[model samples]
Target: MPRFYIAQPLAIGQLVSLPEAVAHHIQVLRLAQGELVTLFNGEGGEYGATLSDIGKRHVSVEIKTHQPREVELPFGITLAQALPEASKMDWIIEKAIELGVSGVQPLAAQRCVVRLSAERAEKKMAHWQGIIASASEQSGRNRLAQLAPLQDYKQWITQQDMHRRIILTPRAEQSLADWARHQSPQAVTLVIGPEGGLSDAEENLAIQHGALPLAMGPRILRTETAGLSAVAVLSGLWGGM
Candidate 1:
């Protein structure tokens, strides 16, 4: 079935017109009146609907049945990823969404190569958000993952508050399995570095802010792969995947 995401809340028995973008897609798909489709409001609920009318400029859908479904990952995993090269960040965001991350935060680490001005940041954020939405739609996730504004390592560390905070480091003696041995947290924040990775000072600061150093395995993974790997492992351990 075709799936579309609506930013607004959906109610039972209410007729709603598809947005301009979705309208174009509907027309391209050549779906006629009374054709079944799925709509979601990005609020953990999906609706079964049928096209009531297909006009030249608008496509109207009538709610047939509302199914309240929760498709969230068992554990909320927030990725504080250090900024990478242009296309790499985009790839990271898309894969992270597919892997069921709750949120993504782009971090400007000491060794980050790509620097974004305020305007560029806004544009990049919009681009990444679109990728996130598309990924959610394709992955059958009703709730859209959040993409936070870009922040530097120093700035982000002071602002985050979570039950479990961690930073990936090769030198760390403690692994994720070691750290997760006795306790299960409602939320976990994982910080991964850019090309050169986080500096020693940044690592110390993250530790000061209650971030446990976690080792992924014997081999070090790239910045783009670390977060997705963590999400899959964490989700599986928590029974979300």
Candidate 2:
């Protein structure tokens, strides 16, 4: 059965029309009347629905039953990443969602190669949000991940208040595994830098503001790979995986 994020209130016996994009997707999928599908409104659980009508540009479905199911992790994980080159951020967002991150924050770091103007950043935020929703639908997440607005490196670092916060660094003395051992499996925030990684000043600033320096392994991972790897490691260690 196909799953879609409807962004609306769903109830039993209610007939609702899907949005244009979703309608187009249904039409393209060639779903016929009475076909079963899944719908989620980013509220809590999902609903089972049957296609009631399919027109040229609209698709309507009837809610049949509701399944109070949730696949979220026991603990929340937020990935605060420095903006990378084009397309890598999208990939990171998709994989991060699959790995059960609760939120994502994009930061502008000193070494970041891609700099987005205010207008461009807004457009990119919208595009990344779409990626997040699609990833959630495919990953069976009833609740969508929160996308924090773009922020400056110094501004964001000074304001984080997560129970556990770690910044990925190749030179950190503490391994991620060792750091995870002491964590309480609560909300964690992982900060990853861009291509060349965070500068010494930036790292110092993060450490001064309660972020622990964590090393993934002996090998240094790329900007996009570091956060995902850290999330998977933490999830597995903390029982979120």
Q: Which candidate should be chosen as best, given TM-score against the real structure?
A: 2
Collision count for each candidate, in order = 0, 0
- Where in model 1 is the C-alpha error above 4 Å? none
Q: lDDT tens string, model 2, 1-241?
A: 8999998889999999999999999999988999999999999999999999999989999999999999999999999999999899999999999999999999999999999999999999999999999999999999999999999999989984845778999989989999888777888789999999999999999999999898999998999899999999988999987
Report the Cα lDDT for candidate 1: 0.87
What local lDDT does model 2 show for residue 147? Answer: 98
List, residue by residue over 56-122, the lDDT tens digit for candidate 1.
9999999889887767887788888999986999899898888888899898889999999999999
Local distance difference test, each candidate: 0.87, 0.93
Clashing pairs in 2: none
Alpha-carbon error at 63 in model 1, in Å? 1.2
